[model samples]
Target chain A: MTLALRVEHLRKSYGAVAALDDVSFEVERGEVFALLGPNGAGKTTSIEILEGFIARDAGSVEVLGIDPGDRQHLRGLRDRIGVVLQELAVESFFTVRQVLERNAGFYPHPRDVEEVIDMVGLSEKSDAKVKRLSGGQQRRLDIGLGIVGNPELLFLDEPTTGLDPAARRTTWDLIRHLAAEGTTVLMSSHYMNEIEALAQRVAVLSHGRVAALGATATLGGRDRSEATIRFTLPSGVAASDLPITPWRVEGDTVEVRSDDELRALHALTSWALEGHIAVTGLSVARETLEDIYLALTRGDRAEIDEEPDDTKARTP
Target chain B: MSTDVRPAPQRSRFSDLRLVAHQVKYEQLAFWLNRVGAVFTVGFSVVFLVMLGASAGSQKVQSLGDISLVSYYVPGFIAYGVMAAGFTTLSVTLVVRRETGLLKRLRLSPVPTWVLISSILISTAIITLVQALLLVVIGRYGYHVAFPSSWLALLVAVIVGILGFAAMGVAISAVVPNQESAGPVTSIVFFVLLFLAGLWFPLPPNSGLAKFSNYLPVRHLIIAMDHAFGVPRGATPWAWHDLLVVALWGAGATLVSLRRFRWAPRRV
Candidate 1:
């Protein structure tokens, strides 16, 4: 697949703090890619560099086959990409249609203003002032402005950060629709479920470094990792009498860790049936994406606690 | 197929002038639809003229060549309206937009930077024009005050004030840290300057208030307007000296804006 974006050795800093260090990633033309990180992990800095909003100290970046750092191509780069910032940037005074139409004027090849309104589900509020709409509706409008330019790639920075469950579901549906229409999306989100639900590939960033990068399901060896076997022991069973070695025992409950879960479960079940030992509450669990994300960024989170608190609430 | 990012050679896509006009249309819509702002700047001026015209308009001050109070107030408040729309309202608007992320969003769009800035400046000029016209009509017909002898001179003063004060507005916005403090900070600074410049009542020439206000751009603008209206009965309409001081201040403010302007919200 042809790549839509490429970055290598990206570095940026503010005074003494390193915002991004040697960050690199590539996004294919029509795929939805995700950047996952805790607060202050360089997600925004990276996105801004890629968008050419700011200059990077050390990096080679190409967005849509053009060097975003080159001033001559800055407008061209912006024309092909759409951005939705964390803030609801729409002015509150103008009606929904007015604001949409105003932004549509900025693009050389803009999508139909009415079509954008309908796609974002704001047709019902077309004449209402922006301030009168609910938070969810405003966010949808923000996304509409992003796509009104008919962008080939879109950037969404925490698109669903402060939304209720229903609103988040609606936003997710909207994003899915855009991706289905062949818009490559690069999104940064703290919501594990959001990443899991939307991204085909994700890069976990920690301390301005790529801690892990792979398929959403298989990152950190999650698919091939050990399975955890848990079950409650019989009341009179002695620990040593078990055929398999137990990892931990608490009261009448027992736990086992196994790399080959099929063999482990077979041996345990056969022995239990022969001896008539009733094992209750038995279940097998594997590593989840959240578990891997936490493990990768645990140190970064501890370090961020020492800084100012605005970056602290990204945990989900 | 994915390697080509340029769209249709972009040169023939659209006109930058049309983009500026479109953005200006929204900017104007935003200014007027926010009724509080429109009333605060435009409506307030109209009300001030009617109230003062009824109370002390016919009385002669004997200080400003014994011109009627209405004559003095008409020019003074015209200057006031210029500062309100170009300086106070524009500065406060910039601060709120900067702190709220609107400015940054505009920066990221495909529109050229010049277009956005030009649109805002144009919208401000339009507001100041409306207020100036309203004040002129009220003084000419409502209070029976003599109109400016050189309408062209009055236009010059108003235009200079708008451009200068608008630059000062952007300059002040760079220093005001956040939205909560924007209104109070700009208002206090604006009202203090207006008071010292004798916007409410004409200051006697060479009085202590006049001397101090002479050092400021505000009084210079009012003086320019007063001369344009032939307030002292046949004085030359172009007070080029006073207009020069106002333009210099605007130039300085433009320098400040260039050096310090920030689009993104402060991290606070």
Candidate 2:
């Protein structure tokens, strides 16, 4: 597959702090690539570099096979690359439809304003002033403006950050539809679950570098051979004389780790049968993307002393 | 994916042109709908015209053979209208956008930055032109202010003045950290210019301050505009010098602003 975007050794700094350091990633064409990071993790910086909004300190970056800062090429690529900024403060004076229509003029083959409006579920609020729309509705309008140009590549930066759960789901569906229509999407979100649902692949960033990256199901070695089984033991069991099986117990519940689920289940059932013990509240679940995300972020945060003031400084 | 030719999107300067025109059109519509803004422009013109009418008598102070105090103030009023359009409209809108985060949102659009800035300039210019026409009509009917002899120079000065002040406003908006500061900063700068440049009242002709006012842009613009009303071009400096200054200021402002502008909120 042709790479839609490629970055090598991208670096940026704000004063003494490194915002992005030695970061590299490739997004395949027509694929949904998610950049997952906490606040101040340089996702915005990376995306801005690709969008040619800010200059990179040192790096070779290419979007659509063109250097982003080359004005002519950048302008040429603009119509094909749509950027949905996190903030949706469009000029409130103009109606939603008017704003979309004005932006549509920049593209050679823009989608119809009406169609984009309907796609974002803002058809009913099309004529309303942008300032008057509810937060979710304004976000929908922002998406409408971004896609009105029928862009081939879309950059969505925390697009659903402040949205309620229902609104966020609606936006997710809209994004899925866009991807299904062959538009490449690069999304950034703090919500790990959202990324698992939306991104085919995710790159986890920490301290100016990629901490982990892979397909969502297998990210951070999640798909490796391991299963965690939890079961409640019957009364008078697990006093350290249970069996030769690999297991640990805390009170009545026992957690067993095994590479073979059938073997573990067989051993546990046989032990219960032999002992006339009942296994209660037995359940099995796989490691989720959230688990990997937490482990990575926790480990990464432990490596750096992030003063709380630094977080406050990043927010307005 | 081979041989997938959908007739690649056309590359055209006209694309930016059309986009700019559309932006200006919508901005103009919004400005017209702003009742407070409309009152400042149109209502201010009416008030200025009525004052000139009431004082059109022996209260006249003649700068040229045929021109009266009414005609002199007519040019000043028109210049004031232009200033308000350029500085107040553009600055207030920018600060509000900054406060509301609208300006940052526009930066993310595919539209070129120049297109966005120029669209605002063009929209404000068009609105000011309408106000100027209203002033002209009121001047002719109510105060009997004649059409100036130097119409071309007056037009050039107004256009250059608009560009210069709009650029300055953009620069001002950039340094202003927020909306509240935006108001006081713009108001102080604007009122100082109006006071020193004699937009409310012309400085004494041939006086040192009046000559010094020649260096101020609005002063020359007003003089040039009055010249459009048949007022002679005094041996003093011509309007073109002020226009050159305005052009330089515009370029300087654009450079400073583009460099200093930030897309995200500042760290407090």
* Candidate 1 residue runs with Cα over 4 Å from true position: A232-243, A249-254, A267-281, A302-316, B1-6, B12-14
Chain A only: list TM-scores of all candidates.
Answer: 0.90, 0.88
Q: After superposing candidate 2, which stretches have Cα over 4 Å from the reference? A: A229-285, A299-316, B1-5, B13-16, B34-36, B47-58, B61-70, B98-110, B202-220, B230-248, B263-268
Give the per-residue lDDT digits (tens) of candidate 1, residues B1-268.
2444445535443588888889898889989998877887888888998899999946997876777889988888888888888888888898888777788788788888778778988898888888988998988899888989899999999988888888888889888878889889999999999899988887778799899898899999988999999977668999999999999999999888876787777653
lDDT of 1 at A102: 89
**Can you write out model 2's per-residue Cα lDDT over B1-268, one digit (the tens) per residue?**
1112245677668766888888888788778866667777667767966875685564555455534667767777777788778877678777777666566556656667778778888888887778777777777887776665556766766788788888778777777877777767887887787777776655767888777766666666666566565554252224556567667878898787767655555423
* Deviation from native of the Cα of residue A65 in model 2, angstroms: 2.3
DockQ of candidate 1 (2 decimals): 0.41
Which one is best on TM-score?
A: 1
* TM value for model 1: 0.94
Report the CAPRI category for model 2: acceptable
The DockQ scores of all candidates, in the order shown, are 0.41, 0.26
Q: Model 1: which docking level applies?
A: acceptable
lDDT of each: 0.86, 0.75
